[model samples]
Target: MFNYLKELSFTRGAWLLLTTSCVALEATALYFQHGMGLNPCVMCIYERLALLAILVAGMIGFLAPRFILTRWIALLLGSYGAVKGLTLAIKHTDYQLNPAPWNQCSPFVEFPETLPLNVWFPSIFEASGNCGKIVWQFWGLSMPQWLIAIFAVYTVLFACLVLSQFKRSSGMRERNLFS
Candidate 1:
């Protein structure tokens, strides 16, 4: 199983699959925002950015999946995205479930000064909804709750890939020592 995972990390198809999944997720976010009139909050915008990071990482890995350096870079970026997304989802869920005047999310989206996403792409990055409002739910789970699950999956997959990479490297070292 470890050997299979190690080989999978070097395949372009695997990276493509990761990128495609993120694309589908982004499309769904757009559909929810425009088609369904579900305005996004600050936390939602941040979570979207995290997903975008993973998507970019997938693209990088797809470009040079066999290159060890490229794979490492992609792994770092994907891990960052997964962890950040998961954290944001949990906080957002908390905001919705335990609303308080002092514990409310900021009204404005605060992107980095160099990358003012809200200014560059208002339609996609702007935050117009209240974070504590439970405007949508499915089967007793709110939007943030659903996002927590999604990010958790991404995080776990990245963790497995990282471990596989380490296993492959150690195996290579052992083979070289014998050779």
Candidate 2:
């Protein structure tokens, strides 16, 4: 059992599985928010953006199966997510800081409001809610906290993948000489 767990942790398949799990978690959270009574706060939306980025990158990486590219993509995204998560957590530590003016969160993209063919949608750029409100939590850590952790892990995994690519390439060259 321990050996199996260790093997799973190091494989590309395991990373793919982890990506899928994260996607499912985000989906479930959204489902609960829209289907149930919970509404997303400002920070929640930011976190969603980070998660979406990761999900999209993961999907693309899965399609190509390039270790180096996948690792670089994960590293870039994980760093971005870490920054966002930290900002949100800091916001939550205080009060009376209006989340409106600081609102960097918005929908992925909404339909254009303009009726004419030439006119584009009037983007009502507005601020959103704060980071303090609890949408859901376990052991006192919010969803964003969990997301941060996941991203960090992904970053490391991708780095390993990058290393694995180099090792595999070198091994292939050696095998060619032997043959």
Give the alpha-carbon lDDT of every model. Answer: 0.91, 0.51
Which has the greatest lDDT? 1
| Clash pairs detected, candidate 1 | none
Give one digit per residue, the lDDT tens place, for model 1 in 1-179: 66777788888999999999999999999999999999999999999999999999999989887778888899999999999999999999999999999889999998789999899999999999999999999999998999999999999999999988877443432222123
Per-model TM-score, in order, reads 0.93, 0.55
lDDT of 2 by residue, 85-151 (tens): 5555455433223345454443333324563311341111121343545556779876666655765
What 10-residue stretch in candidate 1 is worst by lDDT?
Answer: 170-179
State candidate 2's TM-score.
0.55
Number of backbone clashes in candidate 1: 0
- Give the worst 10-residue stretch by lDDT in candidate 2: 117-126
